[model samples]
Target: MQACGLDFGTSNTAAALPDGTVLPIAPDTAEPRLFRSVLFFPEDERTTYAGAPAITRYLEDNAGRFIQSVKSFLHSRSFRATQVHGRTWTIEELVAVLLRRVREAAGAQTGAPPEAVILGRPAVFSPEPEADALAEQRLRKAAELAGFTHIQFLIEPIAAALAYEAQLSREELVLVADFGAGTTDLTLMRLGPSRRGRPDRKADVVGSTGVRIGGDRFDAELMRHKLLPRFGAGTTYRVRGLSDKRLPVPQHVMAKLLSWHEMSFIREKSTQELLQLMLESSDKPETAEALYDLVMENLGYRLFRTIEATKVQLSREEEATLDFEEARISLHERITRAEFESFCQPLLTELEQCTQGLLERCAGAGEIDAVFLTGGSSQIPAVRKLYVDRFGEARVRTADAFTSVAEGLGRACVSLVSPDLINS
Candidate 1:
């Protein structure tokens, strides 16, 4: 029998089998890759869209009817949505759809229902313990709804550590940094031989801080601040180098720029309507829904692509440039190592402060033997540099960077079957 491990992250879902292999199961539908952790429903009815197709449709419709980043909603005190037909759906129901999809994907891929599964949980939230407990309960229920009989919720950073420990028999105190699209989690753990294979001897959760910002947020910031003014959001301007640069930026473009953030919370509806109208008049007959498609497919989508490209390039080179082929917009950004540090300085500083606070609370820094880094965003040069700078380079390591946690969870699941191996 094959055991399954599920890394249910805010942005993507990946599964690992007992044979030590990991695969990301794409969401069901036309766009067969990546789960946005979002769901949409028509306001007039209770129908809901989960995973990839729903994301694409929500982007195209932009009717304010979509529920995005549902994991984030898990942190909310209580969430109730009033649909178009005066119907309301709780956050738990929205999460049910997302988990149900994951269950279907995992079951379909392996041809076996997962015997026992490991899931990721956040370490901290604004409302303190209440938010933490709520997130935990919601996920457990979501897992149950997804058809999993047994569920184990592990701190995300610790899971990453277990993933790292399986690869090494050595005992060390390590810090694990798990950066995802939604938040950044740091854990200082002592990995050693115990009855539990690579068990966490004394783990200290330093901090899990979220800026309500990520690659998506940065892209929207850039588009709103830099691209809109000149792109004719009801007004037009000639391109810097081309005389034919006069073109309208459709409303869909603006909607895509918004992505999953909530900017209209305090703004009046009329103001939002005016903003929407200006965005519409700028380009063509682009609808809000259509603009979401553009945001996911083009604008907000493209901005993050550029950010990711720059992040990857910076890991290898000193500078990077962004080129928007369809829009004919290109910028050659010469980023020095120092300049790159400055770009992410605030976020990195916040992370460091968080780490320091956690360390202060959990004995001392010397107690931590090693620091591990995982997750897609953990690849950011600034993030790695901050950890290396704090803890010596020799003490910082990455197991499988991207797949460590999910892999560890798989191993942990196997240990459950043979209690003796957990202590081995």
Candidate 2:
């Protein structure tokens, strides 16, 4: 029976074949391997767009509703159904649409639809047990709706370890760090040529842990500290009837503006009325006007793209500049490495604590021989330093940022088909 591995990530998705070939399912005409986890629902067209084309259509014509980071909503019980293009869709149904596209692409690559699949999931979907269970249930339903008859779940970090394990010739204890868009997962496992063929390999897993923080959080931090301030994040407005009294603009509204999934809510009638009142009474009317214009023009995604680009640039350079010139909202700001690091200090500290906690949980286990990092957010210099400082530079390793998990999932599927071949 032929099988495939699917890595359905918060920011991107990919599928891989058992023969070590990864299928390119990105809807972009260029056929990039990593498909953007985004959807665009046009007002005038009945068809929906996904991946890069979705982003392009959203930018070219802002009239449509653009949805991103759909994976994050899987755990929210409050998120039931949303209306799009005069049609209502359940969360699972929306996810199924994206999964179906990936399934079709992978099927085309293999000449026949896969009979089984290994799906990569986070260590914990949510801190709450009920929510986590519900999220997994939703994921399974989505996969089934996408036409996958057989499925198995593997922790993402474990999948990364398996991908790295395939290349190991000697016995080693490895720590896999998968820093994805929605979460950072860690897994410590023992791998070697000697243990490859073992039918029961669960004993090799030493520990696994994850924190609900990743690249999206970093982007939010950058927006909150650097960009949102320019759009009146902290500005104050005078009260309508009170004398010598003023109140700060609602921080919740600013938060919604920075959130990728919540930005569209700012365009609601009630929110717009509040924004208009704030603009009329704000001491810094220009900032309020800019914020108002941003919502009215549906420029949240475009602004976020600029912020995300700056974050990526900072990962490679010591300094970066954010220059957004759209209509009446012109802003220019330069941020140095030290400043960026400071902005993300709290999150960096949380990452360190999470890693340390995982190590403590496996204290009696054997020493880790190497640290493997995967996922796009792992490219950040500060994130790299965290592992290098812990295990030394020589023991740290990295693979292709986006495809490792999918490839690892593929390897896991292969193991199920010919256990002796994968183990041997």
Candidate 3:
């Protein structure tokens, strides 16, 4: 196989060849073209698994370390490493494990392992310049670790723009919106048959902007507003001292519960002891104990899976039930579109600010010929309304009738790709 375009997304990953055709990397999953971004390490089992088998293995045995949303932590300064079965794995190393899996799958598709890749990335991984640069550097290191001799990057929204432009018959100035699990990127660029194969697209690119908020943040919001109360997010606890003074549970405990990826880390002895103390001094002992049980049993992912299902259902229905049952905890909540939208109002506002910042670099909303939407979160009616309200319903549309970032990256890679830029 030749150098391919790889979209290693937060929630899912996809790769495409130079011919603008996406590779069905995850043939085992329901969506063959899209591989879920998950990794599982079974207890006492040195064997690791990625993609569909990883999820399956983790779900079946429920005894291993299940990791997701790995891409979301790339830019963090505090997140240095994670201990996986006693060996500490850095962020880049963990990412390399997933990238290596993607490379092998691409190799399987064409019988030639690709060592060159053009990776798709958000327009801004971090607003801070140092962090953003570090994020890109870490990604390149991960690609190198995955055995890619030549690796490059394209802004995700621009890649989507290329895919949109490939199908356009006439020239037009358009705004491409590429939403992923961890970020939403927007690009205003010139596109169409007239400029399809340009080697240098920087001049044609008018502006780009992105936010670190996307579907994952929406999931966190759903968990925070709808589910955290059941786990004692807002409840107060009594002091163990003789004084009758009551204290609220520290917000950090709830924050850990909100983050499924870090939930396992909180099971240290110190945390467990703290939970015991909180359980002993709580006004609502049941909720506090439930919180303790959630951590001890490592049920964060299972609970968040229900949260994800609920969000998906609300995208199509007016209401969805967020339901989950563990040995000791039962969550059953019905939420309407209006209520969920209200919960996500703050996130939607941030998105507006993000897009408004991008539009400031252009003439106006009317100057945009089309608005291309990508990613699963774009299907949310409330999110779609944001663009439609600004740029009329007729002007807004999906990119290539699917998430087109990987396809667009593939098109971008068709321009004289090298197996090894350093050697060749």
Off by over 4 Å in 1: 1-3, 18-20, 27-67, 82-88, 198-259, 263-269, 276-317, 323-340, 364-367, 416-424
Q: What does the lDDT come to for candidate 1?
A: 0.59
lDDT (Cα, tens digit) per residue for candidate 1, span 236-330: 32333465655444455355345434432313464355445544443433333233333333344344456556656766777666454433234
- Model 3 stretches astray by more than 4 angstroms: 364-366, 400-402, 416-424
User: Whole-model lDDT for model 3 versus the true structure?
Assistant: 0.85
Model 2, residue 111: what's the lDDT? 76
TM-score of each: 0.71, 0.95, 0.95
Winner on lDDT between 1 and 3 is 3
Q: Please give the lDDT score for candidate 2.
A: 0.85
TM-score of 2: 0.95
lDDT tens digits, residue span 32-70, model 3: 898888899999689988888988888788787888988
